[model samples]
Target: MKCTEVNRLLNPYIDGELDLQNVLAVEAHLQECPRCNAAIAGIQTMRTAISRACEPAKAPLRLREAVQAQFAGTAAPRQATSLSLGVCLAAAPGIAALLIVGWLALAQPWNAQSNAGTAQGTRIVYHLAGGNHVKANLRTLKNHLDAEPNLQVVVVAHSDGINFLLQGAKDTEGQPYIGALRELRARGVEFRVCTNTLTRQQIDTRAVVPEAVLVPSGIAEISRLQKREGYTYLRL
Candidate 1:
């Protein structure tokens, strides 16, 4: 199978839900592809970290009682019935949809943890995926740098977030945003624009400002910074 096809099957493969044919295909692809193997490892690592971080806690007695009372008046089903094969098949799509949503929600790069006591000296990755908060996030980033001159900051921009990093982009005051970007760059802040976004949006790499570096994928870069480089994640 192709890498793209393998990618779509990864979660189900990991969950042991793939059919025998698909499972064999994905396994064959994985054996020859280091990138996909790395992706699987990353997913497993994030799952482990989230599991450890989100240990279940007992609900307070009052809250539990209140929840129970709210459901007390609900009538139980009159009969317990076994689901037919056709009904189960029909619900499979819905179950798959929920699985995809749940995986997306939980499979964040920031959920993974690096080794403890590594003393990485406060590295941070700021993620920007929308245009709405570009100016506000820039101000906040500047304030952070001003407050902590020693901070190691990296800004990863994708989607409409790449607007501020484009050539001749303007701020709310009609001033060139590149000037502010240059100032931040001078202050040791690294800006990364996603090439995937550029390709998808049909934008030339030359359109990106000199102050920003183009990365293959913004989300992948964020994941690398958080997992491999031990950078804290801040989404804005």
Candidate 2:
């Protein structure tokens, strides 16, 4: 084994886990390589330090109670309880932080911690009724998202309004409406089409913007969002 290969096994070896073959290989290399010998010695020192610092066992809660009771017997009744409680509560914030870190570690799309100090999320809603010009309102929504930024906007299509995002939809100039919706969606604009309207009109959802999601009923979804999710609604 090379110096690097032997170094890789040093920690496990110092912890007494190296296999027979690996031990023989490591021994052969260490006899001749000063670098590997030093590496093994360094890892052995680290193992010794870690073993002395901590052992795999239960927490120190029992010891903590004893410490708290040391002053508890002399203090007044309320003071003793409060001091004991404070001693026990000392780990609360740290435990909460550890839980949050663990959750964020697994929840992140990438393996990373979620920053609590990041900007707050944005939530905005757009109401589209039957027969209104869709291209114009969609353009306005796009402009706001592009310029103001940080604004989370949802376009709710209901009733005849579902045509705004119907498959193969076009503007008065014959430009494909789905293209603009796609572009806006790439910038984070959410398109929600009312299922009630689609069922009534028998429109094919396959033709709508791929970003458009079907809600139970667009009007009801809009109302629920405004009342419950704290969304500010705008009608165009």
Candidate 3:
């Protein structure tokens, strides 16, 4: 990996946010480059200094209660080790955005209460296996939904197409698609991402926007939706 790339990813690496491939690449590069190794050490030292300098504070009771309430409906509530209410307060904006996105994704297909109504409709499964024409495809889907209110649309993304639904992902102009996704979602469109692709590509499921649910296999999902559910298939 280039020095520039290594430098850019150092923080994410330290934060335990890098995917498997990146972790390996960064470790390999750190072994060969003394400069980067020194940089990593310096960053660690700085973090340690800040941690020691700051006074420890207890988490607010209200915040803890709110978090508990939010995950109360989940089949298996997610837990974070070493994550405190203070860390959540420190990154509230970013954390709130991710939480909202996660709520949107998890609420759709996973929540039986919500799915009870959404699951029954004229279904159409859209296959997305490539990144090309993402915007155009989304636009088309939106237009189709506008024409048919009772139609249920599900977008299954895999391979290169998965990047479109990744968190903070942008188009050529550096514009986020979450707004558009939210709009479509409000109109009853669903988005599902493939776990197989994520595993093969060494990507963390959290890296994807919360607007998309994670499916076991994109191709298998498409097939099931078409056959068992009588969903019409469209590839883009």
**Considering TM-score, where higher is better, how would the candidates rank from best to worst?**
1, 3, 2
What 10-residue stretch in candidate 3 is worst by lDDT? 80-89
Highest lDDT among the candidates is held by which one? 3
> Which residue ranges in model 1 land beyond 4 Å of their true spot?
1-120
* Candidate 3 residue pairs in clash (backbone atoms < 3 Å): none
State which candidate, 1 or 2, has the greater lDDT.
Answer: 1
Candidate 3 matches the true fold with a TM-score of: 0.49
lDDT of 3 by residue, 1-236 (tens): 99899999999999999999999999999989999999999999999999999979987764454344334344432433121223322434434454343333333334443332354655666777777556766776776676667778899999988998998888778888898899998888899999999999999999988888999988777766644565545555
**lDDT-best of 1 and 3:** 3
The per-residue C-alpha lDDT of model 2 at residue 200 equals 82
The best candidate in terms of TM-score: 1
Runs in model 2 lying further than 4 Å from the true structure: 1-121
Could you tell me how far off, in angstroms, the CA of residue 175 lies in candidate 3 after the best superposition? 0.8
Q: What is the total number of backbone clashes in candidate 2? A: 1
Q: Candidate 2 lDDT, tens digit per residue, 99-184?
A: 33222222221212322212444465666764545565676576667655776778888876778677677777888777788788
